[model samples]
Every structure is written in structure tokens, then in C-alpha cells.
Target: MIYKSMLLVILLLPMIGSLVGWLIGRKSEKYRDKFNILLTAAELLIISLMFKRIGVEPVSLFIPDIMGTGLALKLDIFRYIFVWVTAFIWFLTTIYSTQYLIRYKNRNRYYAFFMLTLGSTIGIFLSENLINLFTFFEIMSFTSYLLVIHDEDEYAHDAGKSYISMAIIGGLVLLMGLFLMYDYLGTVDISVLSHSMKNIGSIKYLISTLLIIGFGVKASIVPLHVWLPKAHPAAPTPASAVLSGILVKTGIFGIIIVVGVIMNGDIPLSTAVIILGFINMLLGGFLAIFQRNVKRILAYSSMSQVGYIMVGLGLIGLLKDHNAIAVYATLYHIFNHALFKVLLFLCAGIIYMILHELSINAIRGFGKHKNVLKVLFLIGLFAIIGMPGFNGFISKTLLHEALSEAHHMYKTRWFDVAELVFTISSSFTVAYLLKIFITVFMEESEEYRGQYRDHLKKRAIVPMIMLSVVIIFIGLRPNVILKVLEGTMELFHAHGSIEPHFYDIKNIKSSIITIGYGCIIYFGFIRSYLRRRENGRPIYFNPSLRWLSLERHIYIPVGRFLYRSSSVVFKVIDRGIINLVIYLSNSLKSLSGIKVKRPTRVIADLKIKKPKELTRFKIKEEHEDITKRLSKRSMHKEFVTFMDMVTVLRRNLNSLMYAVFILAVMIIVVLGVLVF
Candidate 1:
């Protein structure tokens, strides 16, 4: 009974506190900040009290009258991990935000949504019912949208537009899946659905895809990730920290529930996830390499790191009975990523607070003399790049082992290629991180040297210090987390043990190779091409700026096309009805030898200008054609030169289609073999 009450309190405290904090701030802002910090700390303490219950019988509270489908909350080792981390990060960022936002406007409003977002995020982790999960999921989305646009600038508004738009669409899609799930199974309870999915037939694929996409939007999987880069830079720093650290995990949490819990590791679904994971891994890291904004780079890094987590999730399915390592990798990476990624963002926050700028060129050498900030930043950097003796190394090494285990078990060439991609993506992680470190910290600049030496106080620095300590502790003693992760396996019904030899020579060698690749890429390609002399000073440029944007080119154009198509259909229908009316009127008038007066004016009243509309469609069609030609030419210039051997294949349309057909056939064969 006591535990159940605490569960309710844990879920509702932040939400209630959000309102209370806002009310209190109406009279006093200082009290509001302290209240929020204390509220978050209390949240952490409450969740910590439940840690002793791990591996014991899970605790659940069900309220049947809420949200029309009841509110179901559960506490198990799996959910506990996320809830505790969310509390811990939120508490620290709350403290950090107090100082970070001191000079910014609308402190009270920020705190309200900040705490509100925390509540909803915690709610997501605790939801045992799919509907309950989504209810909180949408709330989190809307609340965090406020956080993203807290600055209320044009950039923030634009980011907010993209963020909210994708979120609403993702939610609606997710709701559709839930609707289908309930219609078919008569329940949206996860536990019930887990058992019911096996009997769901082929329709299960459609349900899972909808759910994955709904969750994938938040997970920032490729093509669904356009909002993330913009949102991070536009949001306040503390918001950015949690956005990358905790919020994205909510999406991953849902996916894990769908894949690991409900579907029970369906092979086809797992294979598709692995493919997307690899795409996210490579594409995010590649884009991060060319970014100029620190937050944007970190945003892409978050996407890439989420990819690593996704790959781990997919491997859990591939490894089957021996999936313990992959499970550990997935869960442990979630924990580690939240720590280091948040730490890096907080460090970036400090830099931003000092200079009000995040461009690498503008802030270069600002950390040269700031030893405390530099060291804190390096800890995050080392951890992210998978340096030996860091938390990232532990989880990344486990991910590598999981991939290797899959390769060994199947002996497939596909796994071999995945392993190669995994190694290369790891190198990209190192390269982009080092790019930030060297350019912003190591490189000397006359303009930024000796600036803002003592701008940060204990309030700001302590949170980062705490995060760094946890990161190092976890890195050194990974088994501590691994042991806790072991408790989660029963939830997934996974058996066997994860006994990763963290310091094994093979693992160390893998880390060294990845790091070496990163160093080579950074010093060789990035240094030579990305930076140039401008006005006798070095400037970094983002070549990806010219690259095709998923939002600008794909999503917007498709939306316009749909809108135009619908408009044309409606206009034609209206014109047909009007012409019928005109014909009848003319027949009546002809009987009296008096034509309808001002017939052209009547037609014009409908506002369906045929010539103008036709011209508009023609112009749009021509524009699209030109855009496609430009995109193809850019692609040719950028990549075709590197693949001279494929020149003939590129030019021959028939040959390209043949290659695609063969690839499709190969994939079908692979899937068939895996399924059978």
C-alpha cells in the first residue's frame, strides 16, 4: 500500500509542482526556482526508495476511471532504470537551469513547462498501458514544444513549428496503431497485448510499423529526424540537455516495449529495425561532421547514439536466446548516453551562457584557460568517443560484442557488412567529437582568448561535476550497471548470462581501431577541407548546408503536392456544378429570349481562375524538375567522382534498375532464409 501511494506521488508530484511553481512564481521567482529544484530532488528520492524492490515482485497501480481506458503504472527493474535516470538528470538540470537562465526572460514560464515535461516523461516510463503511455507521450510532446520555443525568436518559432508538426503527426499515427490494436485485441494493456500479438496474424506488421514510426519520430530515426537538429539549437540549454538525454529515450522506451516486450522479437521486424539503425548511425554521424553549430552537432550525435541503442535493440532479436549481451548493451547505452550526452550539453550550455554564441568559429579557444570547463568537457568527450576506461567504452564494447555474436552465430556476409559499418560509425563519433574539442578548446584564437574567465559559479559547475563523476564511475565499474540490467531480462523473458570481459584485448583493439579511424578522418579530411582562411583568420564552414534537406525538399514539397491535388479536385467539382447551373439558367433565359446578365461575373464569383491555376501548377512542375536536376548534379559531383567504376552504371537507367532489382531479390532471399 505504501509503495503504491509512493508510485502515485512519484508520477503526479512534478505535474502538480509545475502548477504550484508557476503560481508561486507569480509573486516570487526565487521561491519558484528553489521549489522546482526541491521538487525534482524529491522525485529522485522517491524513485530511489523503490530501488530496493528490484527483482522483487513488480508493483503496479491501476486507476480505472482515468483517460477513459484507466491509468496503469508499473514499477519493475526495466522501468525503474529510466524513471530513476530521468529524475536524476532532471534534478541536476533544474539546478543548472537556475543559473543558466538567470539572464534570460520568462523564467517562470520555463520552469513550469520544464517541470511539466519532467512529469510527462516520468509518466511515459511508468506506463503499463499503451494508452496511458501515449497520453503522457503527447503531453510530453506539447510541453516540450513550449520549452523548445522558450526563446520566442524566429528560429525558435520555426523549430517549434517543425517539432510540434512532426509530434502531432507521430502521435496521430501512434493513436491509429493503438486503435487498431484495441479493435483487434480488445485491450491496450501491454501485458495483455504481449500475449495477444502472437495470434494477430499478418496485420501485426502494419501495427508494429505504425507504432515504430510513431515512436521513431521521437527517436529521431532518419527522415523523421529533421526537427531534432533545429529544436536543440533553438531550445534553452537545459532543455537541450534533457531533450537529447531523457526525452528521446521516451521514444526508445516505447520501441523497446513494442519490439522486446510485445512482439517478442519478431524476426522481420527486427531485421527492418537493424537496417534503420545502421542508416541512422552512419547518416547522423556524417551530418554531424559538417555542422558548425555546437548544439546541432550534439543533436546529430544524439541521433547517432540513439542509432547505437537501436542497433543493440535489433541485435537482441537477432541473438535470440543468447540476447543477454545485447540487452545489456541496449539498456546500458541508454543509461550512459543520458549521462555523457547531458554532460556535454551542460558544458555547451556553460559556453553558450558565457558568450551567447554556439558557432565553433565564434567560441573557439574560449575554453583554453578554463581548466575546470575543459576537463569536464573532455570527460564527456572521452566517454562519448568510447575511450578505454569511460562509460561509453563499456556500452560501445558491449554493442560490438553483440554484433560480433550475431555475426558468429549466423556466419552471414550481411552481418559482416554491419560489423564494418558499426566500426566506421564509431570512428565518425570520435571524429566529430574531436572536431568540437580541437576547434573549440585546443585551437588558439586571438579574439576569444582570456574571455569570460570566471563567469560560471558553483550552481552551474556542480551539476556538470556530478555528471562527470557518475560517468567515470560507471566506466570504471561497468558491472554495477550490468548487474542492474540483468534484473531487466526477466521482463523480456531473455535467458542466459552477460559476462562481458570489459578489458579484453580484442575489445581494446576494436576501440583503438575505431579511435584511429576517427583521428585519421578528422586530421586528414575535415581539417583540410572544412576550415579555410577568411580575412586572415580561420573559419569553419558547413558544406551540408547546401545538401538536400528532408524538411525543405521532401516533406514540404509532398505536402504542397497533396494540398494542390486536393484543391484541384475541389475546384473542378465546384466548376462542374456552376456550369450545370449556368446551362439551366441559359436554357430558361433562352425561352424568354433574355440571356442571363453578367454570366462571366457569376463564374468569376466562384474564384476558380482556370488560367492562373493552370499556370501555377505548370510553374510548380517546372520548379520540381529543376530542383531534381540540381540535386542529381550535386550528387554526381560529390560522390560519383569517388566511384569512377560505377560511371557506366550511373548513366544507364536500365542498368541502375537492374542493380536495384538484384538488390531487392537478394534482400528477399535473406529475409526468407531468416524467417524460415
Candidate 2:
């Protein structure tokens, strides 16, 4: 009972504190900052207090007659992992934001949303009911949207548009899936649904797919990931840290529920996730290589690292009873990623705080004399690249082993292909991190020498230093987290024990080979083709600017086409029906022996004439006048007025219409499948 009450407090504190902090800031900003730090520290303390309860029975709270089916919250070992990490990272980033946001406008608004997002995210992890989970998921989306647009510039607004549009679409799709599941299975409780899912037939696949896609949007899966690169760079650095490090995991959390708990290791579904995992891995890394912006690169890196986690998840399904290693690897990577990615973003924040720039070309050599910053950045880089002595190496090595196990068991050519992609993706991770480090730290620039030396403060550096220590500590002692991961496997009904030799000869060699591939790619491809000399300094360029964008070329154009096509179809149908009705009325009057009057002007206009006749007779005079007007005036001015109207309507209504169109199409497809 005490644990359950604490659970409610943990969920509500940050939300309540958000209001209190905002009110306090209205009086004094200093005390508000302190209050936020204390609030988050308390959250972390509460989660840590529950650590001793792992491997025991789970804690749950049920509130009936709320949100339709009521709200259900649970805290098992698996959930505890996420809850603890969310609290920890939020605590650190809140501390970091204090110094980082000092010079920025709207500090009160920023901190309010920051803490609100924290509560919402923690609520997502604690949710035992799908509806409850979605409620928190949406809250997190909206609260975080404010953080993304804090800058309120054109760029930030653009990013926020993409972020919110996709989020709303994803949320609606997720809700549809949940509605269907409840209708079919009679409950939305995750535990009950898990068992209920097994009794259903092939419809389960449809349900799971909808759920996966809904979650995948948040996960930043490819094609759905158009918003991430733009969003991370636009958000404040501290917000960026948590956004990349923690929020994407909410998507992953939902997917795990569907794949691991609901599906119970369904092999076919797992195979599909594996294929998409490799695609995300390769695509994210490839794009990261071409990026010149530091935050954009990190954003893509988040995508690629998530791919690794997804692969581990797929392996768990593939291995069935012997998925212990994959389970451990996935959870551990989640933890490790939160640590290092947050560390790297904080490092980026420091640089941004000092220079207000994130472009690699613009900020080259900014950290040359900043040894403390350099060391901290290196720790994060090495961890992410899976250097032998860091936390990332442990999880990554385990993931490699899981892949090997899958290959050995299946012995199929596709798994062999997946293994190659895995190795290349790992190499790409190394290439990009090295690109950032060497360009920003090692390279020499005359413009930034000895600039902003006094900007480094103890408050800013302390959080990163603490992160570095944790990374090193976990890297050295892999068992500390491994034990926790092992205890959570029962949540998935996974059997077997995880007992990999972390420092084995083969694993070390594999790491070295991946590192080697990265070095060659960096020196051979990136340093050569991606840059050029300008005034005796190397300037980097992104070739991908010319590449086709999913949002620009595919999604938007497709949307416009649909809207135009639908408008034309509806117009033709409306006119054809009117003409048919007029003809029928005249024929009925003649048949009844009444005097048949000449056709009315409205009937003649509505008459369905041949295309050329209609054009020649009806539009001929208008066409002639239009041509004369065009000849008398400049073409640009004549067209600009019409185009401006279209552009305004599209700019204002495109996102909402696109979302509605997608929802409509999804419903049509589902209905067609069901009817057929």
C-alpha cells in the first residue's frame, strides 16, 4: 500500500510542481529553479527507494470510473527500469537547464513544460491500461511540443509543425487500434490483453501492426522520422537531451508491449521487425554521415541506436525460450543510450550556450583549448561508439552475440545479410561520432581561439561529469546492470540465463573490426568528398539536401494530389446528378400529356454536354478575355495572386487535412479488408 501510494506521488509530483514552480517564478525565478531541482531530486529519490523491491511481486493501483475504463498503473521490475532512468535523466537535465536557460527568454514557460513532460513520461512508463498509457503519451507529446518551439523562430515553428502533425496522426492511429482491441477482446488492460491476444486469429496481426506503426512514429522509425532531425536542433539543448534520450523510448515501450507481451514471441511478426530494424540502422547512419549540423547528426544517431534496440527486440522473439541475452541487451542498451546520448547533448548544450551555433563547419575548433569539455565529449563519443572500456561496449557486444545466435539457429541467407548490415551500421556509428570529435575538437581554427573561456560553470559541468562516471562504472562492471536485466525477463515469459563473456577474444576482435571499418569510411569517404578547402580551412557540405525528402516530395505532394482529385471527382458527380434529375423531370412532364415548356436556363447550364462543346460554348468568351488580360499584364503578377491564395490555404490547412486524410484511408483499408 505504501509503495502504491508512493507510485501515485511519483506520478503527480512533477505535474504539481510544474504549477507551483510557474507560480513561484512569477515572484522569483531563482527559487523556482531551486524548487524544480529539488522536485526532480525527490522524484529520483522515490524511484531509487523502490529499487530494493525488484524480483519481488509487482505493485499496482486501480482507479475505477475514470477515463471510461478507468486508470490502471503498475510497477514491475521491467517498468521500474524505465521509471528509474526517466527520473534520473530528468533530474540531471533539470539541473543542467538551470544554467543553460539563464540567458534565454521564457524561462518560466520552458521549465513548466519541462516538468510537465517529465510527469507525462513517467506516467507512460507506469500505465497498466492502454488507454491510460495513451492519455499520458499524448500529454507528453503536447508538453514536449512547447519545448521544441521555445525558440519561436521560423525554423522552430517549422519543426514544431512536423513534430505535432506526425504526433497527432500517430496518436489517432494508436487510439483506433486500442478501440478495436477493446471491442474484440473486451478489455484494454495490458495483462489481460496479452492473454486474450493469443486466442484471436490472424486479426491479431492487423491489430499489432496498427499498434506498432502508432508507436513507431514516436520511435522515429524511417519514413515516420521526418520530424526528428529538424526537431532536435530546434529545441533547447537540455530539452534535446531528454527528447533524444528518453521520449523516443516511449514508442519502444509500446512496441515491446505489443511484440513481447501481447504477441508472446510470434515469429513472423518478429521477422518483420528485424527487417525494419536493419533498415532503420542503415538509413539513420547513412543520413548522419551526410549531416553537417551537430544536433542533426545526434538526432540521426538516436534513430540508429534505436535500431539496435529494435534488433535486440526482434531477436528476443526469434530466439523464443532462449532470448535471455537479447532481453538483457535491449534493456541495457536503453539504459546506456539514455546515459551517453544525454551526456553528448549536454556537451552540445555547453557549446551552444557559449556560441549559439551547432553547425560543424561554423563551430570547428571551438573546443581545442577546453580540456574538460573535450574529455567529457570524448567519454560520450567513446561510449556511443562502443569503445572497449565504456558502457556501450557491454550492451553492443551482447547485441552482436544475439545476432550471431539468430544466424546460427536459422542458418538462412537473409540472417547472413542482416549480420552484414549490422556490422556496417556499427561502423557508421563510429564514423559519425569521429567526424564530430575530430572536426569540432582536434581541428584548428583561428577565429575561435581563447573565446568564451569564462562561460564554463561548475553547475553545467557537474551533471556531465556525473554522467561520465556512471558510463565508466557500468562499462567496468557489466554485471551490475546485467543482474537487473535478468530479473526482468519473467515479464516477457523468456527463459534461459544470460552468461556471456564480455571480454572474450572474439568480441574484442569484432569491436576492432567495426572500428576499423569506421576509420576507413571516415578517412576515405567523409574527409574527402564531403568537404572542401575555403580560405585554407575545410568547409563541410551536406549532399543530402538534393536528395528526395519523404515529407516534401512524397507525403505533401501525395496529399495535394488526393485533395485535388477528390475535389474534381466530387464536382463531376454533383453536376452529373443534377443534369440527370432535370432530364428526368422534363421527360415525366411530357409523358403525363402536360405542356412541356422549354428547358430552363439553370437546366441548360447543368446539362452534361460533350467536353469540347462545353469548352467552346461556355468558356470561349472567358478564355478570350483571360488571354487578352494575360497579354496586357505581366504573367508573373497575374499568376501570383492565384498562387498566393493556394499557398496560404495549403500552408494553413495542409497538416490537419493530411492527418484526416490518412485516418480516412486507414479506415477504408481496414473496412475493405474486413468486408472482403
Candidate 3:
């Protein structure tokens, strides 16, 4: 009984706490910051206490049936894992934000949305039904967009637009897919859907595609990833940390539910995921290589890393009953990436907070002799680049081995392509991390003479140190994470059979090779070919690659086309075709000799009729009822009135932003009926 209430508290406390934080935030930053930290810490304690109570069997808390559908809160081994992951990160981010956002405007608004999103993210992890997952997913999107647009600058607004637009498009696509799912399956419960999904046949593929594309916008799979790179750089540091760290994983978590759980390891969809994932990995890494903004580089790296996670997920489907290794790899990497990525973003935030600049050329020697910041940055760097003793090395090795096993099992060319791309992308990851390190931390004093203040507050350093310590602990004793990962196999319906070995000869050799390739790319090409010395300073020379974006080539054109399409659809199909149908119906009735009148109720007994004043057409008389009907002299006035109304609507229609709002509301309502 106690355990059940704790689960609800874990889900709702952050939300409740965030509201309180907002109210007090207007008073002072100290009051607001302390309130949020306390609330988040309390939520973490609740989650911790519930940790032991969540047994092998799933525990569910139910709300009353809402319009024939019930809301559920289930704590299973799957949700349990992410519950801890999210809370831990949120707690750290809160601590980091306390000092980082000091004196920054809108602290109240930032903390409010921050806490709200924390609750929404946990809800997403704990949801037992798709309706519940999506409900929280929408809340998460709305709250996080506030974080993105918090700076209230033009860049922030632009990124916010892209972020919200992608989220809405994804939601619509997902709702349409889910409508078909609920119509055929009769339920949105994962446990129930998992049992029935096998019988849906080809419909499952369409459903899978829609859900993937929908989630892909957030998961940031290639072609659907234009918003990610933009939004991360625009958001404040802690917000950016969570955005890249955990928000993206919520999308992967949904995909896990669909492909790994509900769909029962659908093979065809798995292949498509693998193909799209490989493309995303390469494209993200390629773009990251040329970026000048440190934050954007990290953002693009997130896309690549997420693609790697997707590849691990795809491998799960291809491996079948042999899916244990891939499942472990994917889950482990999700946690590992969240840890290192958050640390890196916070470290970047510290640099930004101090230096007020983010370009590689702008901050050369930024970490000079700052041992704490340097060491902290290196820990994340090594972890991200897959150093032999870091957390990333273990996961990437497992991921590579899993793909290799799948390839060997099938003897197919595609798996070979997967292996090759994974290797190349890994090398690129090393290259960029090395580039940052070389530019910011490793230049000789003679080469770069400028230096800035490096002394940092303990508030900023503590959270990063905590993250670095965890990354190293896991890197050294990976069995801890490997054990946690074993619990996730039941969710994916896989064997927790194979014991993972991180320090083996094969793993070590692969790490060495990947790191060596990364060094070569950094020193040979990036330093010499892509950068040039101008007036005794190093300048990045890859403007072509930096500006060459999918936004210009693909997303903008598609967005414009969609806007134009909606107008054409409204004028030509909605009004034009619908009006034509009514005309045809009336013409058919007349031709068939059936008198059709507008259906209405009128008095048959009462003798009410038009007044004589209305019937008398006295055009010269001022009281000719010209306001009620168009008398001959008032024809021009009536035409002018009608034209004014039409013109007003037409002028407003030029904006078309309302169409987007209406379309979004309509989709939500439609999905609401299917769920609630």
C-alpha cells in the first residue's frame, strides 16, 4: 500500500513542487532555487524508497475510467529503470542550474517548466498505456518548449518554432497511427496490445512506420532531425543538458515500447530502423565535424549517438531470441550517454557563463591551468569518445559485437554496411572530441597567448564532479550497469543469458583502433586542412560544410510546401469540393422530382407572417427595412458589407497560423475520443 502511493508521489510531486517554485520565484531567485532543489530532492527520495518495493511483478495504480478509457500508472522493471535514470539526472540538473542561472532573467519561469518537465518525463517512463504515455509526452513537449524559448531572443524563438512545429507534426502522425491501432486492437494498453499485435498483419507495418516517424522527430533520426541541432544550442545550458540528455531518450523509450515490446520484435520494421539509423549516424557525425559553436557540435553529436542507440535497437530485432546482448547494449548506452552528455553540456555552460563565447576560435586555451574544469571536461570527453576505461567504450563494444553477430547470423550485405558505418561514425566521434580538446585545452602557450578567468564556483563544479565520478565508476566496474540492464530483457522478451566482458582483448583492440583513427582525423585533416592561421590566429575554414544543412535543402522547402498545400487544400478541397458536393446533392434531388427543403422546425398552427412594412418595397423611404433585407437602393451597401466581411477574413487568413492551431486541436480531440 505504501509502495503504491510512493509511485504516485514520484510522478506528481515534481509537478506540484514546480508550481510552488514558480509562485515563490517571483519573490527572489534564492527562494525559488532552494524550493526547486528541495522539491526535486524529495521526489528523488520517494523514488528511492519505492525502489525496493517494486517487485518482479508489475504494480499498477489506476484512475477512474475516463470516457470509457482508464488512466494507468504502472511500475514495471522497464519503467523502474528509467524512473531512476530520469530522477538522478533531474536532481543533478537542478543543482547545476541553481548557480548557473543566477542573475539570469526569468529564473521563475525556467524553474517552473523545468520541474514540470521532470514530472512529464517520469510519467512517460512509467506509463502502462499508450494514451498515458502520449498525454505526458505532450506535457513534456509544451514545458520543454518554454525552456527552449526562455532566452526570448530571436534565435531562441526561431528554434522554439522549429521545436514546437516538429513536436506537433510528430503528435499528429502518431495520433493517426494510434487511431488505427485503437480501432483494430480495441485497447491502448501495452500488455494487451502486445498480445494482440501479432494478428494485425500488414497493418502493423503501417502503424510501426507512423509511430517511428512521429517519435523520430524527437529521437532525431535522419531527415526528421532538423529541429534537434537548432533547439539544443538555443536553450540555456541546464535545459540543453536535459534536452540532449534525457528528453531525446523519451522518444527512444517509446520506440522501445513499440518495436521491442508491443510489436514482439517485428523483423521488417527492424531492418528499416537499422537502415535509417546508420544514415543518421553518418550524417550527424559529418555535420558535427564542421560546426564552430561548441554547443551545436555537441547537439549534432547527440543525433549521432542516438542513431547508434537506434542501431542497437534494430539489432535486437534482427537477433531474435539472441537479442540479449543488443538489449543490454542499447539500455546501457542510453544511461551512459545521458550521464556523459549532461556533464559535457554543464561543462560547456560553465565555460559559456564565464567566457560568454562558444566558438572554437573564440575560446582557445579557455581551460588553461584550470585543473578542476579541465579534468571534468576530459572525463566526459574520454567517456564520450569510448576510451578503454570509460563507460562509452563498454557500450560501443557491445553494440559493435551485437551487430557483428547479427551479420554473421544472416550473412547479409546490409549488416556488413551497418558494421562499416558504425566504425566510421565512432572514429568521427573521437575526431570531434579531440578537436575540442586540442583547440580549447591543448594549444601551446606560444601559439595562443590570450587567457581568461578559469576559477569557477563550487556549485558548478560539484554536479560535474558527481557526474564524472559516476562515469568513471561505471567505466571501471561495468558489471553494475550490466546487472541493471539484465532486468530490461524481460520487457523486450529476451534471454539475459550472455555475461558481458569489457576488458577482453577484442574490446581493447577495437578501442585502440577507433581512438587511433580519431587522432589521425583530428591531426591530419582537421588541424592542417580544415583550419588555417589568419593574423596569428587559427580560424575554421569549413564554412561550406557548416552551412550545408538539411534545413535549407529539405525541411524549409517541405514546410513551405505544407503551408501552401493547406491553403490549396482548404480552398480547393475543403470549401470548393465540399460546396460542389452540396450543389450536386440539391441538383440530384431536383432532377428526381423530390422536393428537398432545409430541415427545420416551424410553427404550423401559429399565423405569424412577414410584416407589411417588410413586404412594402419603398426604396425612397428611410424605414424600408434596409438593414434586414437588401432593398434596391441599399444593394450597394449590402454588397459593400459582405465584401468587407470577406476582406477581413481574407486578410486574417493570410497568417494561416490559426489553421495550424485548429488542426492540432482537432487531432488531439480525435485522439482523445479514442483514448479517453
TM-scores for candidates 1 onward, in order = 0.86, 0.87, 0.86
Off by over 4 Å in 1: 574-676
Residue 439 deviation, candidate 3, in Å? Answer: 0.3
Which run of 10 residues does model 1 get worst, by summed lDDT? 639-648
Residue by residue across 1-676, what tens digits does model 2's lDDT show?
A: 8989998999999999999999999999999999999999999998898877645778899989988889899998899889999999999999899999999999999999999999999999999999999999999999999999999999999999989978977887788898889878999889988788988899899889889888988999876898899999999999999999999999999999999888887999998888888999999999999999899999999999999999999999998877888899899999999999999999999999989998999999999888999999999999998989899999999998889988898899988898899989999999999999999999988888887879999889999999999999999999999887777878778887877788888888888899999999999999999989999789999989999998888766665666566656555654454345334444553455333232221121111222223231333343344334434522232222222222233333434545555555555433332222
Candidate 3 wrong stretches, greater than 4 Å: 66-68, 444-455, 544-548, 565-676
Comparing 1 and 3 by lDDT, which wins?
1
Best model per TM-score: 2
Candidates' C-alpha lDDT:
0.85, 0.86, 0.79
| Candidate 1 Cα deviation (angstroms), residue 409 | 0.8
> Mind sharing the TM-score for model 1?
0.86
Give lDDT for model 2. 0.86
Candidate 3 has which clashing residue pairs, if any? none
